[model samples]
Target: MFTTGYAANSATLQILMQKEDIAILDMGVHASVHEGCAFTNKKTFPHNNLEALEHILKMSESMYRTKLVIIDGVYSQEGDTSRAKEIYDLVKKYNAYLMIDDAHGVGVLGKTGRGALEDDGLLDKVDFITGTSSKTFGNLGGYVIANKKIASFLKFQSRQHIFSVTAPPSSAGIVKAIDLVDEEPIWKDKLWENINYLKTGLNDLGLDTGITCSAIIPVKIGDQNKMWDIGRILIENGVYTNPIMYPAVARKDARIRMTVTARHEKEHLDKTLNVFDDINKKNAYCEKNNNNYA
Candidate 1:
């Protein structure tokens, strides 16, 4: 395991640099992945565009020592899952490896929180799977899973693993979380219920919740300044959430990212929805007022 999920992502690219000359990435991968790829020759494909991936794979097949394709199991902003099985098949056909960074998906996907790899039935096939303890384990660290030789190789050769401060509490916490996940399945059920309730509430008000299939829902707001203004309103009303804007999203696709968890109650969701609905109306009225003044 690495110190942080970011370290895990960056270290994966570093390890690939050992033999892999080129990496193909999904455009919307976490910024840490982009930063990790700083020294590698890389190409980016449009989000989930297999055709674009194929083009790069065909070009790199004869040129690179190792060609690796990387993607997020779940996009942190929009929450859509990757077509992992398709990508796995496509990369295999090109004699390349696929690395899935499932930092957001681990402990949040699958019937048993096996993450997107399990959901896609690719736990054994995919060359590498990386994830974090922060989100689901509620701890601070990251891990990489692969064959014995690769895992051993990274354990010895990985720079991030070498220099980071060691952890005992954090490691214990993650282990405990794993045990809980195995024993208590009810958390997942309640989590999905909260997700659907909140999503329905947002939909009923006509807010543009982007293509989220997981709990990381985003209420799309195109204007960044206006999105910040609404964010302030939510804060005043006691709903804390992230404002997703460029370069996290397209300039025109700024949004308020909302995450639902088993720890949240219906009362908490109703409070959030009430504030959102109130602020939405206020914003609309102010817009009409400004137009009248014009």
Candidate 2:
């Protein structure tokens, strides 16, 4: 295990990438992955753009060095899932390694919370899996899951793991969360229910929710100023949410990132939807005639 999700991501890439090695990262990968690969040759493909990924992989076949592909199982910003199985095939075809940062996927997706790998039956194929202990785990560490050889290798080679120490309390909390994930199936079910309700309500209001298939949802606002103003309005209305802008996303794709949980009741969702609906009608932000915000 590692100190944090950021640490896990950074350390894994650091261990895997050598000088002259190539890292092909999906554009939506967390920044920690980018930072870890800073010393190596790296390129980013558009989110889930398999054609671009293949082109890079095909070119790298002759390099005779490590060519690693990195992607988040569920993109943190857009809440969209990557096609893990298809990517596994591509990485295998080039005799390269594949890594999944299933930070958002664990304890949320899959039957019985086995995460994205199990959800897609990819455990035998992926070389490394890293995730945060904070989400759903209510802790403050991260972990790297791999084969015995790689695990032993990273134990000494990964700088983040060697230098950082995780507190006992954080470790205990993650253990408890893991127990709950095994014991409590209803939590995931309830969370999915909330996700569906929220997405449906936002869609009915004509908000551009993007291509989300998970709990983290984005309501596209498109303009930085408008996104911030709407975010303030949400807070003023006693609804808390995050505003996406600038380098976190393209400037033209600024959005409101919302997350739903098992704890939220139907009324809570309805209240949020009502606020969005009222805002939609009053501001007409989703309409062409009111496209000034875009």
Global CA lDDT computed for model 1: 0.85
Candidate 2, after superposition: displacement of residue 197 in Å?
0.9
The TM-score between candidate 2 and the true structure equals: 0.94
TM-score of candidate 1 relative to the true fold: 0.94
Q: 124-235 in candidate 1: lDDT tens per residue? A: 8888888888888888898888899989988888878887787666489788888888889888888889999999998877777878988898988788887888888899
Per-prediction RMSD in angstroms? 2.9, 1.8
Worst 10 residues of 1 by lDDT: 285-294
Q: Given candidate 2, what's the lDDT at residue 43?
A: 86
Global lDDT of each candidate: 0.85, 0.86
Q: What is the model-wide C-alpha lDDT for candidate 2? A: 0.86
* Candidate 1 colliding pairs: none
